[model samples]
Target: MSLEWLQRVFGAKVLQFVMILFTYETEEECNTIKDDLKRNPDLKQLLEKCGGRYLTCNKMMNNQSEMRDLMKKIEHLFNENQQQCYTGEMPNTASIRKKKLESSEHQCGHTSEMESNAHLNLILLGKKRAGKSASGNTILGREVFMSKKSSKSVTRDAAVKSGTVNGFPVTVYDTPGFYDPKMGTEEIQKILDKVLLKCESGPCAFLLVIKADSFTEEEIKTVEKIEKLLGEERLNKTWILFTRGDELQEENITINEFINDTEALKKLIQKYDQQFHVLNNKIKGHSDQARLLLVKILQRSFGIK
Candidate 1:
């Protein structure tokens, strides 16, 4: 496939002339283009530069602070997509076909499939009152974690809760709040150090719980501290779980639109490959939401569907 074809997804505002090129490419050609983009460093950098120019120009055109902030969010999203495309990590026709083929084989009595028997171990990490414990309860479809409204940190130590969700044995580790005034720095470090060992042996997904209402300054600092501790490799396994979906619903805002509105959240999400999920802890009968979350975790983290 031509590079022109891949350019169309950026839209007329970004790449007007290449919009029609994708209609004529075959599946094999498309795969070839992805391969070229991955292997050709010069080509990848050129495309990235083009995207950066568009983002810069767009920002310059917007004078209002809110519009400029929105542009920054858009820039993060665009740069993320561009980076994935360059690395051939973004979902394309070839990857979709491969996943479908694997799905069919798994369905055809592939009992030895590793993902089927794999355990999902999730560690909830966030600041105080970010809904970490509540999210843990929602994931297990039960009130296993001590979730309550309070100015003080409800969970004083690391706790483990286990249950089967969406056919996978799920283990959730609910930890103490980061930057809790009652806890010292050394105590917090000891707690996190102990929990890190739990993820060493199994398929793990770190649920970085953040409230959907807003990304506060304390939340941003907490995220930075976590990233510093986990580093980039563990960060890749992390997913942003926005709690209190009910608030977003009450305001008639979709998660996508909400993320788009927050530049910091957008940057964080982009840094993590756009992996995120939303849960309404207030809502009863949230089993469906919990199951769907496990499904997503399986597909993305374990490459299982």
Candidate 2:
């Protein structure tokens, strides 16, 4: 809505965004649009003072409707809310990229690898028996968090486990399940706040664990509650991690095909930019998949090449 609100989500500096628009009459008339923007008396001075690359689409002129809609979408970025802060001097293209890479690193640890590589602090959250603890153990490459069959949540308090994956140190925080009739809202919030204290620099990712075999309307409501708690800003980094990957194998279907076929799951993933991953916590040799998951998390945390 407001430019100030958008600036807060993206950042306070113009360095993070560097798109400059230019108009072109015809594709055949000019091979370059930079020259046009440079020649225009108004734009020429503007470019000299604040250098930026020009993005020109010939269709913008030929299709006014599409151009207007596209402009509106671009303006929304300016109007989007700022989720994190960037302090100190303004960065150049290289510096901005480097900062993103640094953000990918886990910040809740003091290991040497954590210092050099991107550190990731991932919190596993979901309802009881959704396999959050098992998912954590799977990602960490060990049974750091207990996973067992139970009517009640196995993890009463938030527990953290750390390990290295593909040279990057990843920290996993297994939090208690939601909608616990015994626990009050204030208690759950307090537990979350305590777990978040370790993430002073902010978490690289949030894993919303769900069983692959079943996701009901009640579970959807639970997800909505989680989303509300995280808010729009943090939800961008949240990943819908569907556990019990063995079910997909047994069904002889891929995760993509499964979600695409399921109407409810389809919409859920789409709402979050299709940011979801599958894992069979019971399966052995999950290191590869875990690494693959880490790769996605890093790309989501940093910038995909």
Candidate 3:
């Protein structure tokens, strides 16, 4: 909902593309936001100030087909812009597929080796208020995505931001939380479909974010829903990213100790061959926690080591 992140990474032109998609829950809502944008003179000036013509957002009002076409157009433009900066950032999808097919036999159920120069796509997934958004900011080492503590979900749609982490081009997709009462089943499915498309970049690391303190019945059901959505095939690409390590530290408990004490958590980690990382989002500024986690992800998920 915050344009700060979009405006910071991308200019106002991309914001037009994002504004259309962000409020695109229903045709009615999309139309309402479109009308609002039209009436806002400052928004018009903002685009003009950025040397961008105001377009596409109006075109999306007609039908879903138009909206879909606009999405593809904007996404291509965005990726093209991003690829211009980082050398070999996102590899050709066809070549990635070919390489994965060739290396499938050697991959013992893990994701295939990523292109040497390819960027890492880290998809954050979990229940609402599980610190997924905050973890995203932590990983990026900046507050690009909005984060706060509230009963309501902060991220209502899928938002992405990219930056270099430890010299690797990393893009983080912060998705809406699972089992969010605010979101309908169909809406959730649409989000999943979009995210899966991004995953085609190849060798994505699916970080299942959860609080470090407790794993309750609700958390158990949430994990089941995540597994079902990801499917057993993607289990290899998944890793448990436990947030709020500061809480565990307060109680003099290690992440491993917390998991060992919780039977469900212990078994879940074992299910993924002990692939996990703990992040203390409270401890910001020049911390190596995020860097270390990326290293582990690259080594385990992408075979970068």
Candidate 4:
């Protein structure tokens, strides 16, 4: 006889036979049978009885032990299929339990590299009045930091600037403005620790700002100290940013000409593999230009298309 005709003639008896076959097979084999049975209207209706416990058990049993226990219950129900107790209505239960189990299993194999779609956290580190806050605001395309003229360190705390640039999420962390001698080594170390914690994924780029008007001995020394802390290889990820580019207007000097003129600055740039950019915060469109340059530098350095 056809399976449908056989099931119709012997409703509970057929379910009992199917359950017997389900218990002997592996979980994968049982799932295949379950999918096949779902395509049939009569078998689905018959299975919907027996408290619909099988459906709940199938959804909730995530591990092997739970699956084995569920299989035993199904076997017992099949053995007593002719009894009236096996004909009860389905029970009420929340559906999220099964969905939660499925989702957890699906995410178990995910790795940190697989989750690397998170935004790159870039930090701007430099001396006070070096336009670090302005550079950050430019990158974010908004006034995220309070820039003032008093020169009392506008960014006292580490403020985070986050926004999407060209469809890529970019985070720029503005650290407390570093000044030499006045801000001791202990204070500087604290700032470094905080920056590392905030940019744990890795700082895609480090923008070290120096005023173009005059490069001092202290400035060079401070840059070297910072570099030592970040490590020599970190220069691959470093980009020298020359602030106050308007100051070079008197001589009409190009950024390359200016860099070549200063021995200390030239050496620093060369040591970092010649990664530098001139940023004029006083000009109208300079901020946007600097931000675009940084984006290009990061893409090239990190191979981010």
What TM-score should be assigned to candidate 1? 0.62
Instruction: List the lowest-lDDT window of 10 residues for candidate 1.
Output: 16-25
Write the candidate numbers in order of decreasing lDDT: 3, 1, 2, 4
Give the runs in model 1 whose Cα sits over 4 Å from its true position: 1-117
Residue 12's lDDT within candidate 4 is: 31
TM-scores vs. true structure, each candidate = 0.62, 0.61, 0.63, 0.58
Q: Which lDDT values do the candidates have, in the order given? A: 0.73, 0.72, 0.75, 0.65
Q: Report how far off residue 55 is in candidate 4 (Å).
A: 58
What tens-digit string does per-residue lDDT give for candidate 2 at 173-275?
Answer: 9999988777776788888878777773744688998888877887898899888777788888899999979889998989988788779889999988878
The top-ranked prediction according to lDDT is 3
Residue-level lDDT tens digits of model 1 in 78-172: 56556332334333644566467567867796744333335678999998899999999888888889989999999999999998674457799
RMSD, every candidate, angstroms: 16.9, 15.7, 18.3, 21.7
| Residue-by-residue lDDT tens digits, candidate 3, 1-305 | 12333332343344434423333546686677668667978666555543453333332376676678766766665675773432232234434654665478456555433643356789999999999999998998888899999998899999999886655568899999888998976787789779889765566888999899899999999889888888898889899999999888898998889999989999999999999999999876535798898888877876655
Off by over 4 Å in 4: 1-115, 180-182, 249-251, 283-288
Weakest 10 consecutive residues of candidate 4 by summed lDDT: 86-95
Clashing pairs in 4: none
Clashing pairs in 2: 6-80, 8-82, 9-81, 9-82, 9-83, 105-118, 105-119, 106-118, 106-119, 106-120
